[model samples]
Target: MNENFQAILLNVLPLLAIIVIAYFAMIRPQQKRNQKQNALINNLQKGDRVITVGGIHGTVKSTGAQTITLMVGRNQELTFDKLAIRDKRPS
Candidate 1:
């Protein structure tokens, strides 16, 4: 009976270690990036240059609860979701 329990534990140990390693290597960094993105979206303001995930670049014209108005060109403005923004552009 004891030998059977030991065999089961031996089989489970490696699986548990793999799960832990996967969380640290993959899941944790993704979670951190999500948090940073959320913070950036929340802190968005007018006139901030930003790039979208689709590679569109624009200056922020206005901000709303879930959307942003971007001035993409002369006399051209477009609205996009806050989550669509990838990162701010360097000045």
Candidate 2:
């Protein structure tokens, strides 16, 4: 009985350590990044230059409650979901 308990503890200890490492390595940083991204999206405004995740860069032409119109080219505007925006660029 004691030997069986020892074996189980040894197996569980490694698994717990793996879980801890995974959380620190994968989950925590992702959550922090998401929070920062959300803050950026929420503060978006017209005239802010930004790039999308798809590599499209443009200046914001207008803004709605949850969308922004991006002027990608000459008179070519694209409406994107606020969440689709990636990073802001200084004008």
Candidate 3:
């Protein structure tokens, strides 16, 4: 009985340690990045220049609850989902 219990504990301990290390190494950082992206999407404002994940570059013209309008070119306005924004650019 004692030997069986010790063997089980030894096997389980490494699995538990791997789970903890994986969480900190992969899961936690990904979650923080997602939160930061969500905050940026939610706080968008007009006149901000941004690039999309699709590589579109434009200046914000207006914002809606789920969508945003951008001025891409001369009289060229495009609409995209808020999540489409990848990063803001410095003017």
Best by TM-score: 3
lDDT assessment of candidate 1:
0.96
TM agreement with the true structure for every prediction: 0.91, 0.82, 0.91
Candidate 3 lDDT by residue in tens digits, 1-91: 9999999999999999999999999999999999999998887889999999999999999999999999999999999999999998987
Cα lDDT tens digits, model 1, 1-91, are: 9999999999999999999999999999999999999999998888999999999999999999899999999999999999999999875
Residue 9 in model 2: shift from native, Å?
2.8
Superposed by TM-score, candidate 2 places the C-alpha of residue 60 at a distance from the truth, in angstroms, of: 1.2
lDDT agreement with native, every candidate:
0.96, 0.94, 0.95
Rank by lDDT (best first): 1, 3, 2
After superposing candidate 2 on the true structure, give the runs of residues whose Cα lies further than 4 Å from its correct spot. 1-7
Instruction: Identify the runs in model 1 with alpha carbons over 4 angstroms from their true place.
Output: none
List candidate 3 stretches off by more than 4 Å: none
Best by lDDT: 1
RMSD of each: 1.2, 1.9, 1.2
TM-score rank, highest first? 3, 1, 2
